[model samples]
Target chain A: MVRHFMAALQKHKMCYALILPTFFLVFLFRYYPAFSGVYHSFFEWDGALLEEWVGFSNYIEAFQDAKLWRSFLVVIVFISANIVKMIPAIIVALLIFHLKSEKHQYLYRVLFVVPMIIPQIVYMLLWKFFYEPNIGLLNQLLIGLGIVEPDLPPMWLADPEWVIPSLIFMGFPWVGVVSVLIFLAGLQSIPNSVYEAADLDGCGILKRCVTIEVPLIMSQIRLSLVLMIIATLKGFERILIMCNEFGGPNGAANVPGLYMFRMAFMEGRVGYACALGMLLFGVILVLTLLNDKYVRVEK
Target chain B: MSAAPKWKNVQQELAKHAGILFVLFFAFFPLYIMLQASLKDNAQFGNNIWLPMAPYHWANWLTGWLAIKDFIANTVIVCVFGVLLTLAFSITTAYVFARYKFPGSNVLFYMLLAVMMMVNVASLVPLFTLLRDLGMLNSLISLILLSIANGQVMCVYVMKNFIEDIPKDLFDATSIDGATDLQVVRSVVIPMSGSIISTLAILRFIATWNDFVMPMLIMRDEQMYTLGVGLMSLNSGYDTQWGPLMAAYCIASIPLVIIFIFTMRLFVKGLSSGAVKG
Candidate 1:
């Protein structure tokens, strides 16, 4: 048995050699940070120096802080906005899927998904300019259409009330190309026989969509929902840039991801930042598992 | 009855086409705005922001390009080396996990998979500290390494699935011909994985090229900044130089636009596959 084991090891020596760097790098960069995040959350730190062990103090503070919970509420609002965006995305996908010819379908697909190639940061920044109260495209249009007075145009990203709404509206008509593609894939995957059966039953387009298509594409819907949840929870880049300041006009648009970043880097409250990080992780894990269970049970 | 049905058909077609047109406008509006803003000269700036019209400030492109040329070079270097290193490590690791029955392979693979869920802002805090401690701050190498490590989970997962789909007979036959495992992989596996390799390459290249947060956090030096970070600096540097700033945005986005135009099919396929598996 020992000789056989040796022979096996010899046979696969190249595999081990090849995978060694991957193992080392992933452990060093990924797993180490994740585990260290948990450990670091328990101790107070002054810059690079660990001051003292403060068990659950950070969590206690996090719980009591209205601002943190407010950030959570802000993120939930973002998630709901994302969820609301999915309806139009599905409708658009279905519309494209039912196009008269394959060429039209292909053309529209290319046109829609091509914008996705643009850097997301670019998208956010461009909209930031458009939210520039005076010369913004949105305000310009609103003025052109005589909808709002030129001098009194609403500040999109500046006002506390308008900040979150403006952020949500930045990607207006936000049928994300990826969501459309995913939904299209899901729509296409539904066997043609089901459509044929629906047609035989004298189903109208709206009826087919509501009764037949929606139920059939539940998996893709679930997938999109889960992805949206993960993205909204973790993505602070848009907020970081759009706000470009301290959490958008007095923390109105703050989310935990951005809050944690500010705590860690800006304030140098590394320990509390780690605690916030852990909380975000816990939420994501719980939500993902819940989604997985819910989707599985529905199926 | 025939006339009613025909009219209803016409209305339906009109609605479908109108919906398609609406999406087209929404999808292209931001890009169009960017292009328009980029092309506008100072005189045309406040007059009408809708269209670029004649007397285009084509010189703004030159100005923008000159300012951030080094940032573009940094992005290319990071993306090129990053994608190559990621592919080398991920492909080999994925092959082993898919084919070999080594001790603890399953455990390690699942560990990596678990890390996939952990790939988010939560890791950013610790990772920032780790890089600082390692003396890798403000270096493109830090961005490259971090991207490769973080991206490996998905790459390895997808590559392993693709490898497992290849028939066992091919590998067995090659090994029986006195070929080594590496030889078999090079001769048989790599050649069959052309589509997936290209898919992964394109995906990784675009991702690294466009990544904002990682580069923002990792590289503090202005000289080491990627295009994304450079653009942010440009936006913040001048109070309101929308002309040159928009020009830079357009210039920075051109390569990705060209890549997507050419590889639209493969890109979409890659995104769908990654999204599903992930």
Candidate 2:
């Protein structure tokens, strides 16, 4: 077997040669760092100097750390909120799909995509601006509506009670263009005969949607669910940007990812940061695997 | 048809329109606020927060432009070079994977696929240390190299499938005419995969452009900051100059908006296809 493989490699030398750059770069930049991260997690290093091997201590500390666990709890809230946020995109997609005129559907689709042209950082910052205590749109609107006095407007970001909710409410309407487009793609794939069959059976619009449209689009929804979960789990830049490095007031919005970032970059606890990262990575992997096993995608 | 039934149908259509328009209004409201605020001084913004005010502060745009121009230049250079190198490397590698039956090909392909599942944030610390050791910290070259390395996996995965679907006879014909592998790829692979290549390019461009974390971590000097980090600093100042800040946001978004305008059809098509396949 070894000899056969060697001969094949000799025959396909050019193929090997062509792929060398990709192999080199991926190994150097991706694989090497990943393995090094694992190695460094068992050490006592400051990232620049003072290196010492301490087996399992960092992991043990991570398990006992209440602040780290609190961050995980915060992320779970975000994940739940994100699941709710997926509904608006799905509903908008269905509405557009059922539109009688193809031209109108196309026009609405383009309009939905227009907002995505803005940079994501700009979007986050804009939301942060809205949450500002004075001269912010939300406070000003609340004051105008007589919900709150001008002097006593709720501090959206600075107030611990409002911080998490404000972060969740940053992008209002929540009709993500990618999710809408994905759902539309799924809807468009259903044969017209299916709809006609439903109609012939005297199915109402909502009944047809429940019976025909949704089951057929289960795979798309599952895909979006998994992607959203993973993205939410790994995302910290938004919190970092809107809530500052310490993760909002009294660390109300801190997630494990942001905590790791703070540890590694701010406090120079590089080894402990690696351990935190490993824990987060473990949660994501298990969640992804469980999702695959449980959310049986319909064809 | 009865007149009453026809009127009911019209009413249903009107309801649909209303629902869609209502959602669109909220989706666009923040952007509307940004535009209006861009035209207002702090005093005017304080007075009339909701509506457009008089004597538009056009100079705010000038201030915003001057502040972020260097960052924009840095980002453009990084993104352009990153996309081109990623494409060049991935195309050749994918072409090989598609055309050849080499030793351990399955193992190698699965290796590339496995990287997709490895959460990137987990490796941030080690990657930073790796770059520091390699003397690449605080450099645009580090950003470009890292972008190319990260971008290649998905491009190669997508492009390999695309290249394999090209007709076998075209490759055979090229080889019969004494074409080398390079020549065959140049003539056959690149031309046949224009739409997919462009799709991948646009996706990579957007990802690199919008990337905030890596740039924020890697770039130490203000001069080296990308547009995302630059915009953050622009908003982070103590005074909170609303007008100039909003103008800076608009300026930062112009490149992507322009790209989308030119490539809207391809972008939409690519997104739908990606959803279907991915």
Candidate 3:
């Protein structure tokens, strides 16, 4: 048996060869650092470890953190905005589906997804310029359109009450494209016969849309919702660049990802940051699992 | 509904198209604004929200963003090396995970997958300190290693899935013909997975080329900045010079646009087809 085992090892020496580099890479980055993070989370990890074992103190401090809860609320607000904006994405996707030809669909797809290719920081910066109070494009446009009096233009992003709404507006433009692209894909999967039958029933456009389209697109909807929630929760680069710490103008634009970054990296509370990181991880994980459960493959 | 007249249909179609047009405007407006903002002078940009009165098309494109011609070289170095290294490591790693039945492979693979959920921000605190300790604080090598290391997960997962679908006979026949495992991989597996490799290459190229945080944190030296970080710094000391920033943003995107012009169809198909396969 020992000889056979040795022979087996010899026969598959090449297999071990294939895996060794992968092990090295993972060891250096993912596996080592993950344990490092957990280990760091236990003690007061500064540049020096001190290797102190203050069990569960990090977790308690993170839980009690007022900023952490603030981040949570801000993230929830962003997610809720994503949910609201998803409706138009579906409508747009459905419109693309019912188009007369593939050319139109292709054109629409290319145009809509353009914003996706633009860097997040760049896009967010553009919105920041637009978010600036008096000379911003939004206020100027509103005034130009006679939507608001010249003097009565609202201060957004700068005002605490208006920051969330301003962010939602900025984010909404960037996100709907993905939702539309995903929905367009889902629409393609649905058989044409469902629509054919609906048409034969003498059903109006509204009825067919409600019955045939919405049900067929539920999987896409679930996926979009989950992706959006993850995205909104994962908000950082844009908000950070746009608002500049303190979540800008009374912490309205703060989310878990950005706030955790501020706390851990900026403030040097490494243990507390890890706990918050773990919470962020938990949020994404829970949502993804829920999405999988709800959005099962529909034949 | 079946008895509806053609004229009414046209009216409703116009409405839908109008709505779509409205959405398209929203979609394209920011980019248009950026383009316009690039052309305007610093003072003019701060004063106005829209296009400048005089079409300084050349000046707008020239004055601010164009001066960073030096950065293009640094960005190219990082992206080229980064993409090549990613491909090299990911292809082999993915092949191993997909074909070999080694001890602890599953556990290790799952651990890598877990790390994917931890975005770059999560690694910020320790990573900076770690790099500073190692004296790798402002090197391109740090960017290359970190990107390749972080990128291995998705590429490996995707590549493994692609390789799994190849016929087992191909590998078996190669081995039967006196080819070694490495020989089989080089001659058989990779050749057969052209589409997947091309797709992974494009995705990695774009991602690393545009990534901000990692490069920003690591490459603090003025001479060593990637295009992403360099562009951010363009506006930093100068009090957010929109003209130059805008110029730089547009100029930076041109390479991608030019590349996509040639491989646009393949690029679209690559993403779409991969999603379908997944």
Candidate 4:
């Protein structure tokens, strides 16, 4: 049995030997942190140091916090709004696939994905300008076109009701660009003959897309959806830049991630923020599970 | 010309121009606004919509630069080194996964995959404490190390996909000639995988360069700040030196810009590969 084991090891020595860097690195950083995060969640550690073991009290406090609940509500709204914005990317992907020429498909892709190449924070700055109320472009165009009366320009960021929607619009163009790029790639992978056969079968573009293109690209779409969800949930810089706080007006944009930032840095409630982090982690994990169910890698 | 051919030609010309026009408009619009805002005379900015200002030669970028040189340097050091170390670890790890199967390898690989699902936000507090306990606070190494470590999943994902695409027969032929795993990786694997590795490096570089939070949390001193944090400090108009601040922003973004311009093909390639799951 021992000789058999030695021979087996010799046969695959390289494989075992080759992966040590990744295993060691991941074990050091990711798994270690993940386990520690779970342990820390229960311990009631303030930012300064680990407090005496508090068990589920932190979790209970997390459940009871009214602000936390409000932040949770805001997260749901944020996620839904992001779903709305992601539609354009799906459409763009479909259109790119529909293009008769591969060259043209590449052309539009380069254009669409340009926004993503700029870092998220830089994009945030551009949107903040877009929402600038007194001298911003949107209202100027609205008044110029007689869409709104000259005397009444809508407040883009000032009023609490418009805050979340405005922020949502700012983030809309981003995912569409990146997702389109992903979906177009998936579209390309559907062997040409498959599409040619569909065409020979007398299926039109829209019909073929619904029946064929959608199924093949479903994995990519699901991935994009999950990504966009987590992105909106964990959004930080844009909110910080715009509101100059966790949320801009009346806690309207105050999702948990933003609230955690405020709790940690602004309010110095380190333990509460750690609890918020775990809650955010759980919520995201649930959504990710949903993502995995819908988007299988092997399919 | 026949009517069919004539019609086809006309439609093609129209579509071509229309796409270019749309692309140019969207691509250049925000940049135009950024440029205009950066250039407006003081009177033009505070009193009115900052537009139609003089076009200065990267003056805003210059303003950004002077305002945040030490900060930009700090960011550059952390990001450049962070990206390099990440590439070092990820490439070898990916190569191993692609080429060999060993005991518990599958388990380790999937754990890495599962880790990708845990967004960075979730682990920030624990990661902060870990850094503190390790006495990595306010250190440049802390940011670089964390950035490198954080990318364990992404790098593995990219590298694994690229390496898997290479056929096994090639590896066997090389192995029969007495090539070691390191030898094969150094010579055969790395050469064949040049395009993908280059692609991964570029993507990793951009990710680390733009990272805000890790550096924000880890680096203690003002001089240790990266571009993202440094830019934020400048954005407050603390120095109000708009020229240098803009300059610094331009400086910070230039490496990415140059890489984006040159290796756009690889960027698109990475996107497409990610689309093709497994």
TM-score pick, better of 2 and 4: 2
DockQ of 4: 0.47
Task: Please write out the lDDT profile of model 4 over residues A1-299, one tens digit for every residue.
Answer: 98987888788776766666667767777778777766766765666754767787878998988988998888788788777777666666766666667787677667665665665556565666567675566776677689977677778787788988887776544345557777877787889899789979999757897899888888777777777778877777667777766587787777788888777667766666667778888888887777667656555
Question: What is the per-residue lDDT of model 2 for residues A85-201, given as tens digits with 9 covering 90 to 100?
Answer: 998898888999878899999889888988887888988888888888988889988988899888788999999999999999889999988889999999999999988888899
- Evaluate all candidate structures by whole-model CA lDDT and list the values in order: 0.84, 0.89, 0.73, 0.71
Clashing pairs in 3: B64-B244, B65-B248
Query: How much is A26 displaced in model 3, in angstroms?
Result: 2.5
Q: For residues B182-249, could you state the per-residue lDDT of candidate 3 as single tens digits?
A: 67778987899876777677677777877787777677678888776777676566456667678877
Clash pairs, candidate 2, are none
iRMSD in angstroms, per model: 1.9, 1.2, 2.7, 3.2
Q: Judged by DockQ cut-offs, is candidate 1 incorrect, acceptable, medium or high?
A: medium
Which stretches of candidate 1 lie above 4 Å from their native place? A1-11, A297-299, B1-11, B272-276
Runs of candidate 4 with Cα error greater than 4 angstroms are A1-20, A139-155, A193-212, A294-298, B1-24, B46-52, B55-61, B238-248, B275-278
Best-fitting candidate, measured by lDDT?
2
**B95-201: candidate 4 lDDT, tens digit per residue:** 88887777667887898898877756667776777788888889888777777887768778877877888888888899899987778777777788766677677
What lDDT does candidate 1 reach at residue A178?
Answer: 77
Candidate with the larger DockQ of 1 and 4:
1
DockQ of each: 0.65, 0.75, 0.46, 0.47
Q: Which ten residues in a row have the lowest lDDT in candidate 2 chain A?
A: A290-299
